[model samples]
Target: MMKTRVCACQTKDVYLPERARVVASEPMTATERFLAFELESGRPLGHQPGQFVEVSVPGVGEAPISISSSPTRGAAFEMVVRKVGNVSRAMHELKPGDPVGIRGPFGTSFPVGGAMKGQDVLFVCGGIGLVPVRSAIQYVLDHRKDYGHATILFGTRTPAERLFVAEAAEWARAPRATYMETVDRGDGQWTGSVGVITTLLPKVTIQPAKTVAVICGPPIMYKFVILELRRMGLSDDRMYVSLERHMKCGVGKCGHCQINGLYVCQDGPVFRFADVAQIREAI
Candidate 1:
């Protein structure tokens, strides 16, 4: 079993109550993007795939980003971030030695152990959505003998926006894993399929009753992907998705991150399709 530790912090500390160190940082893209940080004191973030962490830069505030590394790896945890907003812009400027506050491995994660044990898994991702789904894919790949076949169908706005090119190429070559990709529009050198993420769904074989579908993508991508998954015969309960929202506190006490009654910060950034379907603005 994993050990869970609880710590108390004073009121003046604006950090996430857990401080992680910057172990390694590298840019996966040319847009000033990089991933840097490691847990300092706590046990490894024992979380399922599709969960996120609340990272803070002291006075700079916090942002919730999905944990990109798999727990099964037992290496340093990782988060992939783009330099888009305030906190992310600030985060991009930091070097490898800087300190950042982290609180969580929070929220529900993809159902991987029991539910996915003997089932075929289909991962549909777009743009940065690959970050969260990467964890689960890595987990499944690591324990390939424990699960059924796995297929990954990914689409990005363009080839330049592809998140994990090298890894994606490697997974494509793996035995039990079939990797396929598409871009909305491609330059001349691109040879992969070109279309929305939904377009790739029909290319794969999905055994609905024996498969689970996990999707992560932009707001506009989720509904369409879910619709496609349903058309493929995957039930709502068998479909899972991770959501992104502005979050202030990692815990549920703060009202800043509430999506209706659900706290996106604590309750989930990941939810079953059935659980979030009734909640307006959840997509």
Candidate 2:
């Protein structure tokens, strides 16, 4: 079969983007849209959790976007894109069948079946941070028997800002799965907890030493969340974080994502807390 490659620039160029067409597109919020794409090569994006890909639009440019859906779920990969800049704004204008260029399933990934196997998995996601952590959450749930209990804690500023309405409900229903969510401020219809994500942490009991926690959220949120986790007995080495950095080039050479000696694009967008704790700029 003939494949429709988006860029004929050849694979020798490390930045070459292959062709992909959007298979599904829906608005998750006023400013964010959920999109799914199938590579023209007829293969899956084959990405692991906590990784991102650089999307390219000819007239615009490239922007790094986290893979929001679990690789275990489907052939097409998904992303949660916010209309914050040029590339993303252009991405929002795309429809179900529009063609786009995809570069990689780049960067380090969460250790799901590896280090997390047979261990309790706890996920803490805040606001848009949930966008990337959702991938790991889905992986853990998909292979539920391979791990112990699954606890998910999510928080957003307001009810309107909550993402993944349907999926959140499913997580709550899964066996051996614990899902709790909160909004900093609630509305008339909001009946759940009302506070920052840290407030939800105390409600769940975890065997901290045997549990591996994956956290992704705002910069300010990390400090408080980690402090609370330490108070709960989880050590720095057992906790992981996904960072949002300025990774202009998915390759390490760009230096845009450098924090001390590490390049987030190559070293990680995802890292174990203890490994990066000393790098003042990394979080």
Candidate 3:
């Protein structure tokens, strides 16, 4: 009989030092925008869903934006931006030919390979939250055979505030994905559901144990939506979210993006509910 020795070693972190050029920039809606960039080496970003990239402009600064495109989409990657602050505002002014620095498709990704394999996924998004969740949603849709069912629930302040309207419409039309959207207030022209994002939760049917819930949104939206998910019997470990704060240096050295001991730039922009539930400032 042979005795097995268990050894533990820290995983060597890999950082992407590559530069990517913006191939196109288009308006997804009045407030939301999309930028497509191709790596200089022409290789795909090779990131899992729910991971984010640190986008930098030399004199301006850098911001953490989620990967909005799926890996199945080829060598290029896309980010959906909602022009909320200075860095995002500067990003909106960039053109197709502009150059930007990219470091990481980093942090923990949604547990797609774990709970999501052959299980249903419920994507709950609000405002710009759709940006990160879109990456995972698209991945599941692209690899439909590996998953069971997918439900996407999105909400915004108004019709004009809706991000990725065209893509949302297209996803709604896809047979494999169920898409539903709502707005807080609507103009007379709007026909979709009108209420806070939490309202959409009760309308959907999901098996808590067999479902993985991914949520991302503004700070306020997270609190309310998370409460609803908990009421639905979704375990804290099965719920995932992405956090956003001002990020100066993508590396952990800069304290500008810290949430207590966790650096938003390094430890996360994505964290499991089980991990962040104890951090007071995390929400």
Q: TM-score winner among the candidates?
A: 2
Candidate 1, superposed: residue stretches over 4 Å from native: 1-16
For residues 25-55, what per-residue lDDT tens digits would candidate 1 score against the true structure?
Answer: 7777766365746777747877778788888
In TM-score terms, candidate 1 sits at 0.90
Give each model's clash number. 0, 0, 0
Query: Against the correct fold, how does model 2 do in TM-score?
Result: 0.95
Error of 3 at 184 (Å): 0.3
Give the whole-model CA lDDT for all candidates, comma-separated. 0.82, 0.92, 0.84
Give lDDT tens digits, candidate 2, residues 1-283: 9998878456378788999999999999888899999999999888998899999977999998999999998889999998999999999999998999999889999988677889999999999999999999999889889999999999999998899999899999999999999999998899989999999998989998799999999998999999999999999999999998878889888888898999998889999999998989986
- Report the candidate with higher TM-score, 1 versus 2: 2
Looking at model 3, report the run of 10 residues with the lowest lDDT sum. 8-17
Tell me the lDDT of candidate 1. Answer: 0.82
**Candidate structures ordered by lDDT, highest first:** 2, 3, 1
lDDT of 2: 0.92
**Residue pairs with backbone atoms closer than 3 Å in model 3 (clashes):** none
- Tens digits of per-residue lDDT, candidate 3, 17-36, equal 46789998988888778999
